[model samples]
Target chain A: MKPLLDLSVYLVLGPQDCPGQDPVDIATAAATSGASVIQLRDKRGTTREQVQLAQRLMTALEPLNVPLIVNDRIDVALAVNADGVHVGQEDMDASKVRELIGPDKLLGLSVSTQSELDAADLEACDYLGIGACFPTISKDDAAQVGMQNFRHLTEQATLPVVGIGGISLANAAQVISAGADGVAVISAICGAPDVSAATKELSSIVAARKDLG
Target chain B: MKPLLDLSVYLVLGPQDCPGQDPVDIATAAATSGASVIQLRDKRGTTREQVQLAQRLMTALEPLNVPLIVNDRIDVALAVNADGVHVGQEDMDASKVRELIGPDKLLGLSVSTQSELDAADLEACDYLGIGACFPTISKDDAAQVGMQNFRHLTEQATLPVVGIGGISLANAAQVISAGADGVAVISAICGAPDVSAATKELSSIVAARKDLG
Candidate 1:
């Protein structure tokens, strides 16, 4: 088993999601302010950009002792020696990804459906992200897995769980209260006018929930 | 060794390049009209879209006997059981891609510079894509390797060579005459008003050049 991550305020940002600001700067700010984990999910850039930016991100986050997770593209994750890789149902199977990524690197699998959650090989990934806890703009097709389903799935997950998709400051506490280790958010922090402040607020919320528990 | 492909008109199309038309429709038309190979280079769609579309493309082209090569994303290629995969200098290392895809699947590596060509592990891939034979739009960053340099690389290359970038009916024969087996094109066939006519014309040019040789 991999070392457990704090999972609180897991910020998922990319070139496509960052808009006008540089992703590195956004990630740097989020990391320093309290984001425990960072995931690079660039859906719009070229393969070169993905690899290059990920290298930069690894360097940026290394000193902070925070882990950088690559979304979907294991090539970039392996090339950059990132902390982990997160895959959806459509990407390479968790078992194959684990075999290729090997034992040391962290692996995260997203489970949006009960069958998918039920069928996920327990040995493949270090953690599970269950969502769309609410409607999400990032993945418009994601079936709304409502808070009730999110709680149910989290209860059944063998590994640590995080709430993904459409999570924000307004309701991030709800995700933790429902028994997840953290909330994986995109726009709430990446699109925030003040990224650092947004991250601090979100992290405190999850930290507080864990403290309460 | 992977079987040497009939390199005549290699059509590189993707959801991003096909514009108003469905990528499948465009690929089918080009394949039937004489495109010897088809590579899906989608830098735009989601991972699910990439895999699902590539699967549909494989079924569509299997009967026509054209190979479907996925660009950059090896996971999609492996998931869909694609005939092959094409990678650029920035994607996964050719040797590593070869290692994962194994011996049977065709592997193509793109070399835009002399250093990349010189360092390329010749035994790793079945073929190489060399170019921006002219100023090409598909990848604006591709270095413009004029015909002189393109021919030099092709001559030095141990594997079959295909000219990629800015190739069209007007300039494809030049690529063939330059010693490359075929022209790997994107906009010329995918963006053409008549996809079938464009493919037939481009394929004939390559065939004619080989005949003259």
Candidate 2:
């Protein structure tokens, strides 16, 4: 069995997400406030740069007891011993990742369409991130799954589901109420003026919803 | 102790090296014609593309008994279970790479300068690739080590040496004379109209030099 992951208010970030601010600082602040986990989704840059950043993030998040999840690059995740690795529809095959990362590490897979959800290997994944819960611009190619579809998928998912893409304090409560175990955000906290404040608000909403659940 | 390597003629290739030809075909033909080893040094494309290419190359070279070495990307090398991984002085640290690859996999490091040679962890490396034998245009940043420096460095190396970068039939003999255990080439074989013929000539030169020694 894989170790438990507290994925509530999961923060997804990258160099592209943080242009003026430091990602480590943002991640640290987000975790301190209420982010349960963080994913380093770097699409561009050399492997050396990615490794250094992941190492720093892992060290910073260690004391906070927050998991540092890496996106796409399994090597970086393995090199730094990140808590888990997250892959999308286009990334490496989830089964290969599970084999390389071994049984102990957490593995998360993205699901949007009914086909993708149906095809996902639940045994290999610790959690499933389902959404594009709203239409905002973190990713250009994200498959849009609004609140109704998001709720429908979350209900059918055997594994824990984290609603991602465009989630914020405004709709985080709705996401949780709709049956999602957590809400994963990219720009919500990282792009906010007060990263900690944004995280705190989202966490409260999740807490309130969980109390009712 | 490390396993004895057959370092007669090593072929280094990437998509950039093969313009009109397929890299797998070139590597396969080169290995059959007498290239002792092959390294997939891909610099462009997505990790998906790199992994697929590496897997194909490994399968193609396995029957020929030519070891496939992946440069810079430890994940691709690990994903495909290639014979080993090769990194340059500017790539991942040799010690870390050795730890990730574990003891059995072949690890090769690029040592073009005396300082690099001095700093190299010989205990962790199966071989050292030293070069830029005549300064042709395979890589613009390659350290240009003419015959004299090549001989000097090759003689000083405790690990087996494969002279790489800009090496071809004309100067492969000279590299062998310079005490290199093998010759690694990019454009020489991959770019040749007849890759097998070019590899055969280089292999013969290396074999003749070894017989004389």
Candidate 3:
């Protein structure tokens, strides 16, 4: 049931020049290059080595079950119980990480403004990892909310935003025609030579704009 | 030589009701009851038990030297390299926590609004904790910013705000005359029966309101 949320073309893999790509080989090469949602931001390990690399990237995405999110360690996403956590606007406050990753998990919140996406609460989140959008070499980015702040925060959000930090595939359909419901990248699938054809050309350009109307 | 920044009072002691309280006995009982700065919120350990309770609350406040903030575990405040890390408006972007707590650490971000303190970056922080100020039993609240948003984020801040949830001592000098430079508490110094006379009655009503201004 929670498997159909295809977090829409999102991918962020960096641990320095893909240093022999790990997190279960970058979540099995960004879930067979259609990168739906696989963030394992490795800020130099040790929560028992990021919960043994989020338990070998949740047992190598247990055959593309695709949902291994764990960026800012909510206790190594509750000690390797990964599948939720992306917090950043300065961390821990989407109603306290939805009361410590509970209400059916998967809480993400890395917005860039529009007053922290209207001081975020978005019903204790399920999505909204907004962005750095343009100014990024991957990191050391301070402020750069471009793509016209993704059509003014997906035309005033109601949850489900994605679009994080310097998305690629040549501006990924101009950030999904400026109202992203998805598009997050880190050096386009960890500086791809071919992370499954750059995540199947940004998931077939977000599945051919999945009814953007 | 860092002790004068003590904006009155702020405390929170609950790690199984204090006994040899960690984070240097909840920051030397909030700097011997006249607390200037001491944020050590340990949400049930293990980053090696909150880096050995922030290295035994930074060695029991290294001879009462105050300033020891480490709430959202930035690698246990850079591994007991405590003296800065409050983060929350949602945790890591007061300029990437002032670039991983650099430029001589001490970041603190949490502003509720006034457009996240006017899209804060107010020189990448040194203060601005603001808060719940009134309605809080505390399990990580995120939408209460009242008391007229403490006179509109204290006339649209310039940093140095610190008002935190449910402050006591009967609303502690009306949250330091609603321009708060300090007034943080958790059931007034860990539900005081005398946490140093409730930290000297909220530090003598925020130092007798500078003789009522």
Candidate 4:
């Protein structure tokens, strides 16, 4: 059986965004403060370093029962024994990732437009990371998916949706209100002065909005 | 211009091999002791972790001017601005990795037999990781490519060849004598009590044999 995914306040950590902080510390803080899922999203680093960090993060997260998701790098995911992986349009296709990761692990795909959603094999993915709900510095190339489109895409997707791209406490509720099951942020948490506080604030907003439904 | 790849004494690091050793420390020790290329091979961990690790390894390797190669993760390679990527036959096709990594970065492909070599897009690859010269615990599924087949594959390849799978200082000379430009090893180095000494020993053997040519 596939494992359950907690999409609420999903935090995607980027080393570039964290600067002085260790990824493990940031992840632990986020998880402790109620970030439902933590996706490690490094675009730089050797696979060995990645695995080392993942092992460290896993040690911190396991006690909290927060699932650790890897972004791309199925080999790393398999090596670290992560809960799942998230892939972008340029990364391996969702179906192939599903085949490699198998039925048990969670697989999330990024989709910014209706066409991408149409092309994606929803059955292969446990959830959809849909957006740049707004323009995002987190990903310079991310095509903007305005509130209307974000809502439309969320409604259209058969899988659960986590709104990504430029998401913050100020705008996160809007995404949840627009029908996103959760909001995924990078800098909002990683770049925060206090990662735990940032995560807590976002989690409360998501919870409040989710409760309204 | 793209950075030159030493290929000689190529080291592939696996998380399983280094229980307590930091990959960066191992890589640094290996590079300092004359391992020409370092390939980070992790079958687990998130992409973020991999990139972070790669960045650290890159920092350790940069001053020594050693190239850092990622195993089976073009996205991580691209994100970390790694020197190149190595892909197995079961992973992304070499042509696609070539296109994504572009003209400058090195791209290596793994081939176990002549058929696999013939099927590969040679123009897209800078080198071939030809294996398993002997049965290997590093990868349980690796098909054995005894010395004769290893020689045959090396002779058939147009690109530089690195004989992998069960390579060690004891047998590494045999692979170099079989026309391999280098040897790629996992446990042989990472599992060593002294990674630098292991790398130095392997480098000396590979060098002496290559000198015979």
Per-residue accuracy of model 2 over B67-147 as CA lDDT, tens digit each: 899998888888899888898866777888888889888999998888889999989899999987778787888878778
Error of 3 at B175 (Å): 12
Indicate whether candidate 1 or candidate 4 has the larger TM-score.
Answer: 1
Docking class of 1: acceptable
Q: Tens-digit lDDT track for model 1 on B1-213?
A: 354487788988888897778999999999999999999988766677787899999999989989999999887887787899999987877887777688999999999889999999879888999998999888877989899999999999988899998998899889998999999999998888899998888878899999997
In model 4 chain A, which range of ten residues has the least summed lDDT?
A43-52
lDDT string, candidate 2, A8-46, tens digits: 789999989999888999999999998998999988767
Give candidate 2 misplaced runs (Cα > 4 Å): A1-3, B1-4, B134-136, B145-147, B211-213
Q: What CAPRI grade goes to candidate 4?
A: incorrect
Model 3 CAPRI quality: incorrect
| Stretch of 10 with least lDDT, candidate 2 chain B | B1-10
The TM-scores of all predictions, comma-separated, are 0.75, 0.91, 0.34, 0.56
Q: On residues B1-213, what C-alpha lDDT tens digit does candidate 4 reach at each position?
A: 678967888989856667877889888998999899999987675555666788898888989999999888776676667898999876766776676667999999999988898899999999999999988998887999789988988998999999999998779889999999999998888888778788889888888998998
After TM-score superposition, what is the CA distance of residue B153 in candidate 2 from its true location, in Å? Answer: 2.7
What local lDDT does model 2 show for residue B17?
89
Provide DockQ values for all models, in the order shown. 0.28, 0.46, 0.02, 0.07
